[model samples]
Target chain A: MNPTKPTDDARKGDVVSPTKDKGWFYTDTVKDHFFHPRNFMQDESAYGEAAMGMVGSPACGDAMKIWIKVDPATGRISDMKWKTFGCGSAIASTSMMSVMVTENGGMTLEDARKLRPQNIMERLGGLPARKVHCSVLGDKALRAAINDWYRRAGQHDNIEIEQGRVIDATLKITDKDIEEAVLDGADTLEKVQAKTKVGTGDPSCIPEVENLIRFYKEKYFGAE
Target chain B: MRDIYLDNAATTALEPRVLDAMLPYFTERPANPSSFHSMGLRAKEAVAAARGTVAGILNSREDEVLFTSGGTESDNLAVVGIPRAYVAKGRHVITSAIEHPAVLEPLLHLQKKSEIELTVLPVDRFGMVDPAAVVAALRPETVFVSIMYANNEIGTIQPIAEIGKEILKWRKEHATPLPYFHSDACQASGACPLDVEKLHVDAMSVNGSKIYGPKGVGILYLRRGVALDPLVRGGGQERGIRAGTENVPGIVGLATALSLARQEMEKENARLIALRDRLIAGLLAIPKTRLNGHPTVRLPNNVNISFLDIEGEAAVLYLDAEGIYVSTGSACASTSLDPSHVILATGLSYEGAHGSLRFTLGKHTTADDIERVIAVMPGVVQKLRVMSPVNLDMKYFA
Candidate 1:
């Protein structure tokens, strides 16, 4: 008695490719954003005046650069554009993020700052489990753009860099940071510890580091 | 809207003649070949005839042919089965890095279990495995060497004949009862010459899907005394090498398809090469695009190109939306998000690997299809490149 039964058309084998099912790995919304990305920067000339923020690298196989124009009077994001060289998840995540920031007369700088990857992922009906890291890239770049905006406006005091909840202050490693490390192919606690040096500075975070490794691995790879 | 199916290397539409030949076996003469009856004997004769047709195409003995489910099964039967059968003689195996996963995965699995020491010879920039490397990797303990006749992704044709000859020479000199040569010629059966004797391969794998045949049938030429531990053991079919009830219809379809392919291969190859070259030239006209494989010595039906800054899956999806079927990499490996290892082995950057696309032409592919793709591709590349985050001006990123 499954609630999500295959429709009559699917049962009839009318669907040529099994991957065409919207709910298979990615939702229809994600597919839509990936297929027809909105407010994508057409070229360098299109967003020449917008503040830009870049994250990740081509070598890492995912990179995102976001551009934003803030309304001076309301300090709201007046316009947004993005370019992403990554998989469907990263491209759709950034595309959805640009819409989220600029739609409905745009979000205020503070509201944009408060925006996290989860909000963007939710708007796109969630990404694949392993691709959750791609979602993290959007807000990180948004924050970078907001910082750039502050710097351009000579509002040094207004700029705020959100720091991770430091589990190891000496090594500047946090649980969230450790989770990102795990997402970046550190499938084991030892690998995570080696890459981020999460627990080396302070032995107390070792247990948390191990827990995060297990948590992320299970979350991404599905209990392998 | 007309759909142009360019992903032929993935699979092909079955020919009507092949389908007609298959129909009788399906409904009119459905019998278990192992049964001791007239119907069984008829089925057995049909299978034997099909085997003869396949053997004729490969220039091998009829008894040497063993039927399997498809290319993957045939490859597994050769790669894994050979090592398992002859491990006492040698624990080492050699294969090219650019082999289809059907060949590569089984060898890798055996390596992972420490059952065999696998030497994966790397390909050149054009995706061609060096015959010299295959020769160098040969050892007295090397029980098997498997390489693809042509790469499915980049479409680069390997020197399988030369490599096979070298393997034979090495075996002769060393007096080793080992290092059997196997070529996964699943992609080569339609366009390339595949006489097993001429190639000097101990065994060669062929499948129906690539040659306008049925999907469920494959043939492996075992070169008579070439030993293989059965991957599937059952009713002792295919000379106890592969065991299952005969798929009479599929076997018949495969034979008819291979016969048809061989008949028209010379003319079809020339037609496809012209179309392939035109498509490659037109696609490469787009700024910052590069052809992925060799210029002249590639499969006539294959045109793989990479655009700078954009992800290949996006380009493939865009082409799909335009009613043209293509692939970002091997269809078998498309579900994974990783950049193609074949591209990576060619010394392309990770970004370049991510930015590649494969467009394989088929028998039905025409000059009009190539023209349509050429007209539409530049816009698709421009759209994706505009959306790509990596700035090509950045030397390190590009």
Candidate 2:
């Protein structure tokens, strides 16, 4: 398993990594899902169908999409598909997720919540240390997709979610605009506030003002 | 299959001879070099001999060399220490836009403590910092100017001696204390000659890992009149600049590696230069490919290019599948999806930045390795381009 020498059993896409000799390290189970990525597309015309596409997170470094179709008759999953914009483990985990749903004959909201990263990795031999979270995203994405399906079916009352913090926004303030403002005697935070006619609405204006304040604070005065 | 390692700027394989030299220090003659006993005496002699060996290569006195954990710590000590020590004289510092984070981040941290003004000079498309621009950017309060001897990513060699001359002239005319200049020569150590006096720098940071030694050892070369505020406390090792028990094996390996690398430099650099050119030529032969760094002024061992309409990560993974290891940009910062600051400073577009890959050759890299990359690269780029969001037909290069 030493990386300096080639392994006799080395195959395409096999990662014989630093931890390879340790039996705990991952094998190439991702090939099954990568070559034949199962449930790759959604049922476009199904009833009670919903889609959720998520991009980067602090935890997982890439994006993914999940679509679920619920059968109103059985109150269960009719069909589901996922498209991943991430690592090999992400693709494999999502592929396995579709199979898990199929085997279960659709998912109950409780069953969907029970889905874990460990279950996906166990089925896929195991994920690499850094990529364990990549598989975790599939389960989270599945729950989100199912929740979206429930919401579309007017079942929002069953879920509880917390809202993130909100702050004032600003607009139309580019780096060039800030530079021009500084040139026009906006050397301090108070000067910038007075000079630039920026309001708390557009997303770009606040960050620009903050950067000016930061620079001025470092140079002539102190940060607020 | 065997993977070809082309990320020498990130780290290198430990040289066997250096490892052999370090073994006795770790096993047979283990003792604290700071102690006064017989075992300690021998250990102290070993350290002094190692210091002399490294000093010979840089043409500097052994007393000037202060060991640290690695390049980052060395840089932190040089940038923060000099500025903090000389704050009463001036608080401004100047550096280039294309310097490694080792130099840039510490300067950024120093900005928080004092009324410090940091001027990051811009670079041309080739990532070379102009000496004249540096002079123009200098202010009365500018106390230090930090720049890299060579770039790690695009491999552009900075005009270090020319910049040194400009700074000297400015100091003489103004009749002010000269700004201490520090260069992080970690990447440039083995690739280029590290003559401290000829470069006319106050301090320079050198890393062992880049020169085929173990990872945790480095040197900060502080010229005799350059004052520094100590970064660490307790035990009073590294001339009180850095305070910790000596990493004896790491230090021995570093000294051995530096001596060997300095000896073989000219021959090794020639070998790398030829291989690098071959890599660039093969890469450019493909359609819609643009070279990032200066063709001639760049490091002899570094080749960086951007393939239009292809995702760098996708191309990297494809190459990885073929047992050929390369990088999208600086290996240290590549974990983040944002394109490298070095690439962006060269005035490449965000897409252009994302499309870039750096292949840094080393002492181990061969013509065969270049040939392997040449054979596999075009196909990898083509496959990734076909699957990419942007159409390859659109010309993106400026």
Best lDDT among the predictions, by candidate number:
1
Q: Return the top candidate by TM-score.
A: 1
User: Which lDDT value does model 1 have at B370?
Assistant: 94
Please write out the lDDT profile of model 1 over residues A4-107, one tens digit for every residue. 22223222211235576442356778789988888888767867767888866654456778899999899999998888877676788888888899999999
For model 2, residues B106-212, the per-residue Cα lDDT tens digits are 88877766557789999998998999999998888888999999998899999888888888889889998669889999989888878888887889999889879
Q: lDDT per residue, candidate 2, A1-224, as tens digits?
A: 11111123322223457565643223656656754568775433452236453422211123456777767778676677666544445566788888887665777666765665556666676554334434545665676676676677788885533122111222223343344345434565444443233322233446646765566445444444
TM-score of each: 0.86, 0.73
Off by over 4 Å in 1: A1-36, A42-50, A125-134, A153-211, A215-224, B330-335, B393-398
* lDDT over C-alpha atoms for residue A113 of model 2: 59
Which candidate's DockQ is highest?
1
C-alpha local distance difference test of each model: 0.81, 0.72
Taking the candidates in order, what DockQ does each have? Answer: 0.36, 0.06
Q: What is the lDDT of residue B287 in candidate 1?
A: 83
Clashes of each: 0, 4
State model 2's lDDT: 0.72
